[model samples]
Target chain A: MGLTRTSLTAEIGRGANYTDKHDCVVALAGNPNVGKSTVFNALTGMHQHTGNWSGKTVGTAFGRYTYDERTYSVVDLPGTYSLLTHSKEEDAAKDFLVNETPHLTVVVSDAACLERNLNLVLQILEVTPKVLLCVNLIDEAKKRHIKIDIGKLKKHLGIPVIAITARSKKDIERLKEEITRATDNPSESAYTVQYDDEIEKAITTLREGGVGTRFEALRLLDGTPEAGGDSVPSGAADAVAALQIARTAAELSDEIAKALVKTAEFIAKEVVFVEKATDMRREKIDRVLTGRIFAYPVMLLLLLLIFWITIVGANYPSSFLSNLFSSFEMPICRFLQRLGVPQFFTEMLVFGMYRVLYWVVSVMLPPMAIFFPLFTLLEDVGYLPRIAYNLDRCFHKCSTCGKQALTMCMGFGCNAAGVVGCRIIDSPRERLIAILTNNFVPCNGRFPLLIAMTSMFFISADTAASSFWGAAFLAAIIIFSVMITLFVSSLLSKTLLRGVPSSFTLELPPYRRPQILSVLVRSLLDRTIFVLGRAVAVAAPAGIVIWLLANINVGDASLFAHLTDLLNPLGKIMGMDGVILLAFILGFPANETVIPIMMMGYMAEGTIKGYESLSALKTLLEANGWTWVTALTVVLFSLMHWPCSTTLWTIKKESGSLKWTAVAFLLPTVIGAITCILVNFVFGFTL
Target chain B: MISLSYTPMCALSPGECGTVSDITLGGAMRRRLQDIGLIPGTSVRCVGVSPLGDPRAYEIRGAVIALRNDDAEAVHITR
Candidate 1:
C-alpha cells in the first residue's frame, strides 16, 4: 500500500469573484466516520472540528471554500448506508439530493471499504448523475494492502473519480478542478437496478397505471405514496383503491423491496472481492460485547462505568469552578458599586443575575466537557451501533425500531440533540415513543443535579476515597434511573402508546477512534453552551427573584422562609424541604440553575451550609431534619422529575400537539411523586 | 357485481382494489410513514377498523399501514 502522489497548492493569484452573487454549490456525501469533515476543513481552510464517528453531522453542515477566486458552498450531508432512508440521516441525504438541487454532489467513499459505500453510490446515481466519486481515506486503504483501480471505478460509476487522503490537500486542488469541470458539463445519465421478474411485472403494472417516472415507479413499487403519509390526495387514494382490486398492495411492496435488495446484493458480489475477511480479532470481541448471553450484562456494566466516570470526573471541577466563580462576586459587586448604580439594582444585577450565570457556566461546563468527549470516544470506537443493536430487542418489544437506541444515546448529551436524532428512527410510532421518552435519559443540564445529590446524600466521608468510587455511585444512580425509564416506557407501550412494533433493518457502523480534541471543543461549545445559555438566561432573572424573596421580610421572617414554611409539610412528606421543592420548580426552565438557586436560598435565608466534606454535607442536611430516607427520596424524585423547559418545548415542536407535551410533562411528574410516596411508605418515615 | 376500473383507497366503501401508480412523500408526513416499510410495489388490502375511522389500516409488506383517511387519499392507483 503506497501513499498517493502529493501535490502542493500553488495559489493561482486572482481577484476574488465579487460579481458572482451565488457561489457554486457542492454537496458532500459520505459513509460515516470517513474523514469527509477533515477534507471539508482542509479545502475550506476552516477549523470546524472533526470527530471519529458517524451521526455527528445530525443536520447538513454547510461551509465555503474559495478556489481560483470562486467561492464554493459545500453542504456536508449526513453519512448514510443506502439512500433508502432506513434512518433519518439517509432520509435527510436523499431528500437534500432530490429537493435542494445542488450543482455538484461529491459522494465520498472510504477507499478501504468501497463496497459497502458503493451501495449508497449506486442508489444516489439512480436519483441524479451529476456526481463526483471521491475515494477518500486512501491512507487507511493503503494500510490494508488493498489497491483500487481508480480509472476502472470512475468508468464503472460513469463519473469523475478522485483518489484522496482528505487530511492532506495534495490532490484537493485537482479534485476541486474536476468538480468545477463537472459542474460546467452536468451529466444527465441515471442508473437502474435490474429487478426480479415479479418486481418487473409489478413495476410494469404500476407504470402502465400512470407512474411513468423511474424514481416514482420504484417508490410506488415499494408502497410509499409519492406524497407523505399525512397528505394523500383523494384522487390518489381512489387510484390506490383501484390498484388494490387487482393485486394485494402490501405483498407488491414487499416484493419490490426484496427485488431492490437482491439487485444491490448482486451488484456488490460482482464489484467487490474481499482479499481476506475483516481481521477476526474485532469479530471475536464483538461476539462477547454483542453476544446473545453476555450482551445485556456487558451493556449494563459499560453504561454503569460511563456514568461513574462522568460523575467522579465532574465533581472536583464542578466544586472548583463553583468556588472560583463565587470568589469573583466581591470584586464585581465593588466594580458595580463604583459605577454608582443603585444598591438594590446592583445586588439584582450582580449577586442575583451574574452569580446565577456564573453558577450555570462553572457547574455545567466541566461535567459536559468531560462526559461528551468520553462518549464521543465510545462513539468513534463504534460502540453506539452495538448498543443500538443490543437494545433493539427492548425496542422491538415496545413495538418500535431498534434504532431509537441511538436517539436515546443522544439524549444523554442533550435532549434537543436527541430530539433531532430521533430522525434516525424510521418508524413513526417508534420515533414518537423515542421523542416522548428522551427526557428520561437526563441531559447535561440534569447531570449536575443528580451528581450533587449523589455526592451530598449518598457518599459518606469514608466512602469518598477516590473519583472512581464516586463515579461508580453516580453510575448506579444513573442505571437505576434508566431502568425506571425503561419500565415506564414499557408500561406506556402496553397501555397508552400500545401497538405491535414496526420492523426495520438497522446497520451497525464500524468502530473508529474519535478525534478527541475536536469532539471536546465542539460538544462543550455546542451542547454545553447551548444548554447553559438557556439555563443562565432563565437563571439570572430567577436568581434575582429568589434573592428578593430572601431579602424582603414577610410577617415574621424573610419572604423566602415564609413560602418555604407554607410548603414545608408537603415537601417534608416527599422527604425534601420547601427550599428544595422551590429550587426544582425554579429550575424547571433549566436544571443548570437548580444548584445555584438552592445555594442562594440557603445562603441568604439561613446558615452557611456549604461543606468541604461529604459527611459534613450530610451532617448539615441531617441537622436540617433530614434522614437516609429523605436523601433516598430526593434522588428518586430527581430521577423521575419533569424535563427542562427546552426539552418540553422540543417535545411540543416534535409532536406538534400541546396534549402530548402536557402528557410528557405530567407523566414524568406523576411517576416521580408515586416513587417518592412508595419509598416513604416502605421506609416507614412520616414527614 | 364488478364495477369501475379504479376505486380510491380512502373511500370508506371497502372491499375495493387498485394498482398504485405514484407516491408523494415529504416533510412530517414522510417521516411518519417511511418507517413502516411503505415502499412502492407492495400489495395492499383495506383491513377492518376502529370506531373513529380516522386511521384506516392497510396491510402492506406483511404488516399494517395505519394512515388517516386524509393521508390515504394521496395514493393514486388503477385497478
Candidate 2:
C-alpha cells in the first residue's frame, strides 16, 4: 500500500507543528530500550513526553530545543529494530524518514549491544545521508566492559558519531554541538550496503529508469514499498515491474536482506571491542525468572507482591487524603454558608461536585501513586517482557497477540490507558480483540468498590483476616476477569475478528538498574497525574448531573428515584437493586464515584454528601437492603461492565471509528449482564 | 565438515545451538525475523521456554528474542 501525498503532508504537520519556527527538524530513532527517549527528554527538557515501553510512542512526539542560540524542533520516532520490517512502528519511522525528510536524523544505539542495533542504523543510513549516530548508554557499556570506537565507526559509516550517556547532561552539550555541526554541514552519507550482483543490477535499472533512489528501488524490490509518495514515474513503474519479475526469478529480496545483515555484522566487528566477556547476569536471572517451572509461580508472586504493596501502602495515604479533603470541605461549606449562597446551589457545588471530587481523588490517587511507580519500575528493570513471554502461549492459544497481556496489565491502572496501549499490537484484528475485551479487567477506579464490597460482605470481621481475605478475593476476581478476557478474545477472534494470531519478535531487553527518581517522576507525571486529571475533568460535570437528578422531583419521588424504579426489574434480574443500577448509569463518567453515587441514592439525598467511614457506609448499605448477593453481583458487574465515559471516548479516539467504539461499549455490557444474570439465577435457586 | 540435516528452530532443545539456514515464512513475518538478527548464517541458541511452553526464547546476536512455536517452526536451522 502507498501513502497519499495528503496523508504524508498531514503526518508531517502532525509530527512537527512548529516546523515554521524551528531552524531544523531532527528525528530521533533507535532500537527499543536504547534510551533514545532519554536523549529526547534531556535535549528537549520538559518539552517532550517519553513513552516507557516499546511501541508506546506510536506517534511522533515533537519538542523544541535551543542549541547554540538556534532553536530546533526534535521529533522522537517510535523505537524500531529495523526499518525493513512491516510492523506499525517500523512503518511510522520509515514513513517519517522517507516522506518528511527532516534536516537531521539521529540514530541512537545502545553502546553495550551495538551490533544488533547497527542493523537499523545501516537501514536508516540508506535513507538519509544527513544522519548523526548517537551511541548512548556508554556508562552501561563501561559497566559491561564493552567499548565502541566511535571515531572508527563514524569513519566506517561516513557519518558523524557521538558517544554519550543519555541520563546525564555531561555529554548532552557535546551532542547538541554535534547535532548543530551535522545539520550545518549536511553531508550525503557515503554509507551503502552492497547487495548481491543480481539485486545490484535490478536496483541500478530501477534507479536509472527514474525511480526516486536506490532505497526506494530496494524497497520496491522487497515487495513492500511504502505507500503514499509522489506517484512513481511511468518508466519507473515499468522498471519496477521488470525488476519484480527478475527478483522473483532470482529471489533477490532475501539476498538483499542477507547482504544488509552481513554488512552490519562486518561493520560491527571492525568497530566494537569486548575487553573481557563479563558474566551474563541477565541470562542467569532469566533462567530462573523465565524457567518453565518457576516462571508462572514467579509471575504470580510478583503480581501479588505489587498489589500487596499497593494495598497496604495506599491505605494510610488514602485515609489521610480523605481526612485532608473532608477537613477542607467543612471549611468550604462554612464559608459558603457565611457568603449567603443559595442552599441549593451551595449543596450542588460543595456536597455534590466537591464530595465526588474529594472521593475520587482520595480513592484513586494513593493506589495509583503506589501502583504506577512499581509498574514503571518493573518495566524499567525489563521484567514486563518476561511477563509477556510467560503469558505468550496463553494469549496465543486464545488466537490473539501476546502483547495483549501487556495491554491488560495497563488495564489494571486504567482501561482508557489500556485502550491506548493497544497501539502496540500491530494487527488491527487482534488489537480490536484486545481493546474490546480489556474492560474485563477491573481498573484502579473500580478497585475501591471491589475492595470495600469484598471486605464488607465476604471477609471476617477481624481486621487482619479481612485484609487478607480482601486481597485474596480481589486476586480471584482479577484472575476471573483475565480468564473471561481470554475466552472473549478467543470468541471474537474465531467469529467477528477471524484471524490467526500473528507472530511478533518480543525483544528481551537487557535488564538495567532502574533509576528510582526517574521511575517515580515518570509514573507520577505521565500516568498517575494524567489519568487523575482526565477522571477529575469528567467527574465534576457528572456530579452536577447526579445532583440535578436527585433534587428534581418527578411527581411523588425524585427523578433519580423514578429512573431507579424504571431500572428495578433489570437490576433485580442481575441481583442488584434499582439504586445500585442507577448509580452505575450515573457513574459512567468515572467508576470511582459509583459507590458514592449509590450511597447518595440510598440516603435519599439530593447530592453525594459524605460517608464518615466504611462501617457507617456499610450500615447505610444494609439499611437500604444490600445483601451478600448484592455485593457479589456488584463486584462481578464492576469487573465486566461497559467502560467509563473517558474510556469510551478513548476507544473512539484510538479506534477512530464509531462502529468499533460501539462494539467495545456493547460487548462488555452484554457479557456483564449475562454473567450477572447467571450468578443471580444460580444463587436464587441455592439460597 | 558440515551436517546438511536441518530442523525447525522450535524442535531444538533448550541450550541447543544452531545456525539459521533458511526462513520458510514469507512477507512481513520473514522480514521481521530477519530484522531481529535471525538472518541466514547467524548463530542462535535456544535459551529457555516460557511457563506454558509454546513461546521459547533464543539468544541471537547477543540479544534474547521470544518466538512462539508456530513462528519458530518457520525458521530452519542447522546444528
Best by TM-score: 2
Q: For candidate 1, state the interface root-mean-square deviation in angstroms to 1 decimal.
A: 13.8
Task: State the lDDT of candidate 2 residue by residue for A1-687, as single tens digits.
Answer: 001121223356573554764468999999887888789878887523343356656666666788788888888888898886667788889888998899999999888778888888888877888889999989988888988888899889998999998887879989999999999998665598888776788778877878766777777777665577436767677766776775572266677778888888999899889886533787789889988678877877787788778878988998899889878877887899899998888888887788778778888899989988888788888888888888988899889988899889888878887887787788898898988998989888888788889888898786776777777887788889889999999999898899888877787877888879877877787777777888899888887788889888879999998999899999999999898998888999988888878987888877675467889988988998878888899999998888999889888877889999899889989988998899999896765
* Candidate 2, pairs of clashing residues: A2-A227, A2-A228, A3-A227, A3-A228, A4-A228, A129-A189
RMSD to native, candidate 1: 11.0
Model 2 chain A poorest ten-residue lDDT run: A1-10
Best candidate, DockQ: 2
- Runs off by more than 4 Å, candidate 1: A1-21, A30-59, A78-95, A138-146, A171-174, A187-223, A228-271, A292-301, A304-312, A315-320, A443-473, A592-611, A685-687, B1-79
Model 1 per-residue lDDT tens digits across residues A1-687? 000001001011113332245898888887666677777766776444455534456455666888777889887777775565445677778777876678889988777667556656766776678888888877765655566777766655667778888755567888888888888887655456656665565555655666534455555545555445223333344555555566676555544444554454455455444565343444556557666577777876776667667767888888898789888888988998999989888877776677666766776677767766676667656677667656655555556666677777777777766775675565667667787787777777777666667667566554437455666777677677667657766777888888766534343444554566666655565555565566666666766776677778877788877877787887776767887787777777667766555655655543112346656555556667767687777777776788787778767767788988898898888888888878878885454
- CAPRI tier of model 1: incorrect
Report the TM-score measured on chain A for model 2: 0.93
